[model samples]
Target chain A: MTTTTAAPPGGRAARAAAPSARATGPSTSGRRRLAPWGFLAPAIVLFVLFLALPIGYALYLSFRTEKVSGLGLGSGSRTEVWAGLSNYAAALGDPEFLASVGRVALYGVIVVPTMLGLALLFALLLDSRRARARTFSRTSIFLPYAVPAVISSLLWGFLYLPGVSPFYDLFERFGWDVPSLFDGDLVMFAVANIAVWGGTGFNMIVIYTALKSVPSELYEAAELDGASQVAVALRIKIPIVTPSIIMTAVFSMIATLQVFAEPTTLRPLSNAISTTWTPLMKVYRDAFTRGDLYSAAATSVIIALATFVLSFGFLRLVQSRAFASEK
Target chain B: MRLTTGTRIAALAAATALLASACSGGGDDAGSDDGGSAAGPVELTFWTWTPNMEKVVDLWNSEHPDITVTVNKQDGGDPAITKLLTAIKAGSGAPDIMQAEYQKIPQLVSSDALADLAGSLGDDVAGQFTDGVWDAVTLGSDAVYAVPQDSGPMQFYYRADIFEKLGIDVPTTWDEYADAARKVHEADPKAYLGTFSANDAGWFSGITQQAGASWYGIDGDAWSVDIDSEATTKVAEYWGGLVEEGVIDNKPMYTPEWNAGLNDGTQVGWLSAIWAPGVLAGNAADTAGKWEMAPMPQWDADAPATGAWGGSATAVTSQSEHPEQAAEFITWLNTDPEAVQALVDETGIYPADVPASTEALTDPPEFFSNQPDFYEVAAQTAQTVQPFTYGPNINVAYSAYNDEFAKATKAKTADAFVDAVDAMQQITLDDLKNQGFNVSE
Candidate 1:
């Protein structure tokens, strides 16, 4: 709603300032003074409350520890003391925590590339003119987007069962040895597949929208110059949607870092998935299960900081190319 | 003339204040009690996860026609606790009677969030229930926080036809059990004696309890972890060996593979509690008459004959509007023979009330091929259970042990397995210490 209201006023200002800014340009001080604040307010408010406030709270909590004096006999014996960096040191030194983070990193390595690649391919295919049953294929592929991650994991979990699965049944009919998807080595892939199936369609739609926003005039010019559809898609369309792809990639990375629901839901089906299967899962275990919210809060802050550093570092590295045309 | 920014801020503040005050005023008005209970009928809300509570509610309603009881079907254990905690924190809209698990009873009782039911119920009502059931709901020694609902007596359910086919006898000792399992697997290359889900500590707990492993001791406010004891190690080693020998099917519970094992006869048997029979019936309808119950194998022939698996209790929350009525309903559900019978007839829940089981013992069902003595499981439950203390962080300890057990079982050698268990025990102790549990070195 704000986008609609703000666009008209913003466009008029942009048009008015364009010529003068283009001439004096390097420093559009007048427009820059009003533009940045007006554009940033809504996002800044959300970021402060949802992101910065919680991080600050967690940071404060992480540095504090409960001290129990003289047998901890009563309420008087227990007091809150400043812990400083002990909790962080403990969490980092923990073998279980390190192992869980390593497992998740490996899982992300397997999942992120495969999911984004499939999403990009599907988006390109949907954009192609000669593709058959486009609407049906698009809807079917995107249908999983409507289902919650937990529900999709449950469905896929049942399908992975040797007795219930149609795929397993076919394997049995052919007298082929079908290794259990829930076996120790393969369970990570099973969990990753659930996430990919649930997420790829949504990413595909984002990429597709970005592709659609690309000017058709570019394609027409390429066609007149005797370029193939593949060539146009590779050279023109991809370059145009690079920013969106990077955004999706960064989001996917963040999401993969916080993978909890799929693995948690699938735990009822596989013994290989420990309660501390992922870093977020370990945080949950520490907080609710172990009732060590102090450590849990500390671990969460660590994760949040890692995510911010990773996403920011990535964006900074890619900003020159992806955001170059914006200014 | 320039308008001050303070004036704009004042205008916004005044509007927000007005809106907040109006909302608060409305909330206060609705929260007030119009008159005393003597003038009108009292309506109480009862929240229960067990489906059998509907019949119990119906029985209660018929007895006291003037008082209306609204039974709300809440989701199972963890979600119910979360919902209750949230409602309590919000300071409104909590149910009067909540079904609580035994392990959670200590946490709830210690928090002083539950009403003292012992005063209202008295000895007559409490006397009829088994001591184990009663002890589960008791907080310290004398303060009864809740009333017991059902008993989870662990039993071994095996396929008789499969046992005969494999030429293996029902084992009385752990050694024999392993040998039989090995024989079964040799006979049918794909079959396993039982399934163990590494995440499930309930089954492991039952095994340890049968081996006479106590979790915690209560000697004047001090607590100790007995997980490093010899009995617990023996049980863990036995399970680990089974895993190595491939005698046990390592399928996760509630999975289709587990369900298939139950129905398709890929699994020879399962170690289940009293409630498991009902679960099996509910899940595997096609595998109806193929199942028969046997007692769980002992570590040695002289070991204890029984161990408790899963059970739940009903508690009246501190926020209850009618604590007296809630306590009365819970007392009857736990002790009254007729009420317990009604619940069993309605929900197939094996009642923990000793007197109730005596009366309900004759009821025959076509599900188990008209087995008239279904309550025999209850009798065994009462005889075999040794009291064990469930600590505040028992859930955490259970999960930690479960993960460790999986790791140990999957290990190549017995030494490696023992080392893994030792590591798990140390970590568990450290975790308990961190959570403010009184752990002895």
Candidate 2:
């Protein structure tokens, strides 16, 4: 969703740095000290241009706003003025913005847990020696991540429509009444379903890699002690992959907060999704649709702060409790 | 010091961007200097969404040898306006010509995105369109922002077969329409007269306009919002009551269910605009001969009136080096008899240039071939379209309408509908004040 915005800031610095970095790999001499500097220059440039500049621009824009004079006709009638913290204050006070944040929080709560659980289950199943068609099952589970979010959302959106859905026919055949999976309370679940379908594969692969990296001796020792396969997985494999689970959980939490593509793509199919259905969506609408870039910038800054606090706080909590026994 | 340095670098980058745009503008100046002369060839890019607009532009290109117009097809209405405004802020990449909606003229003008064509166009250009249509581009001022192309004077479209089958008369007034809706629903529980589209803000705005409500009014230099005006509340209550009583469907238009309803003869009537034929043809091709067009049922039958939904004008962007040439092409494209004929034949639009539209739209569209006098009634309805002013904060109000009306439609109550209107008014007014626009209390 933000590929267009992300490209411009990072464009100049991210160009053709790979070849330069690869060519000058840590020449070990005092005389060749400048060689490593040449390699590091590209990454430094990218960080400054992509990360630092955009953040700075957003901060500057958040503190300033347009002052529309009488009628606001002609050029210079709408002039930029120092707004201080007014844009931030307005964003926090806006009911619509608050509603959007709350909705995304609900969406995150639905998506993250369900997605991680399915991913873990799939990983555990594939890791068992008794499992058959392992490669086929693994590929199929991981395939959805290859499809972009927007495309998957559209696919699910059509299936959710009663007039076009095969499920509609099945429901009628069963003599049951099921309304559209859009609008009202049902839309949140509909959006979360698409996210889980598209996201589970990637998370599954992460857990699978962590499972493979675990020593086989632990499972053997558990089995020799008369533990079942389920017992072995629950006790040995699960405990070993706690860090990977935490990593994936943190990533999913961040992605959940920044859920833009699925809801935006499904918007035309349902009136349930507002322009400010999510905080990122709210920023897009305010900046592009309402033509209020200052408020949009402020909202972005606030959302960024929230994402940092939430994800880092979760990491701190997990490290304290989940890793205390391991340490 | 480092934080201030970040601010300084950011400011420098912005200045560099502005300078880069200024340099590009200089380049276009050089290119357009040659364009000013008849001997030099000029190329112009136009962005529009009207179907088969390229054929109309081809006629212009053939007749005018020195100037070449390239049509870049875009998504209609709001998306196109959004892109244009984005380009305007970025200070580059806007097309030489743009398709501007009537409601967005003030926003564009205030943003300084559109070039006012007061000096570029001929005096006769103002006389080509109705005063109401002309005033839309000008914002009650003398500066012309765009050349009027098409006008959507809304009319009622109904299934004549369904009306006849139910033994109901074609409704002529708002009260009769409600009675007919109830009768139709009673005869067949699956069917409805029409649906109240919560998603379609323009559809609701047009209905409000038809009810003698102007949501925005400009006095002196201040803008006043009236979304909660008595006329609009009355209009909302009328639809809300029907929905609440389960006579009218609460489903939105342009949805798959609505399309299925149309195909199955469960949605009997549509309150839509002049371009309804194309949409009907696309959605429910099987219902071709069964449908018919009529004037929108009047609030007071003694004085008939209607409102606009979707129409756009040909505008020149401020970034365009050759506003005069762009204006000339637009004028000829909209008003020239040959160009208008080609436009009508190719794009299937109801031209806003009154004389050209009258001359070109002699025959009915293919989808409504059952009614030979379709354009005749359309021409008459076009004349009765009421004038409405648009403010800069229209986007804010439209989004609010979507959110509030969705809830109201779900609640299915007349009171909720009225409250939705109140919410829209408050949101729009607050937005204007927050954006620092001078708004009257």
**Candidate 1 clash pair list:** none
Best by TM-score: 2
lDDT of 1 by residue, B241-352 (tens): 7776777766667677777777878777888887766777877778777777767777656654677877888889876767787787778776777787788788777777
Clashing pairs in 2: none
Taking the tens digit of each residue's C-alpha lDDT, what string does model 1 give over A148-229?
A: 8788888998888776788998998899998988766688889889878988888888899999898888989999999998
- For every prediction, compared with the true complex, DockQ reads 0.17, 0.24
Per-residue lDDT for B1-441 in model 2, tens only? 001222332333333333333444444444455466666667889999888999999998998988889999998788888878867776677889999888888899989999989999998989999988998998899788999999999999999998998898889999999999999899988789998988899999999999999989998989999999999999999998998999998876787778888899989999999999999999999999899999999999999999999888889998897787889999999999999999899989889999888999988999999999999999999999999988888888888888898789778899999999999999999989877888997
Q: Model 1 Cα displacement at A1 (Å)?
A: 40
List candidate 2 stretches off by more than 4 Å. A1-33, A321-327, B1-39
TM-scores for chain A over all candidates: 0.82, 0.88
Off by over 4 Å in 1: A1-90, A128-133, A213-231, A291-293, B1-39, B65-68, B87-94, B302-304, B409-420
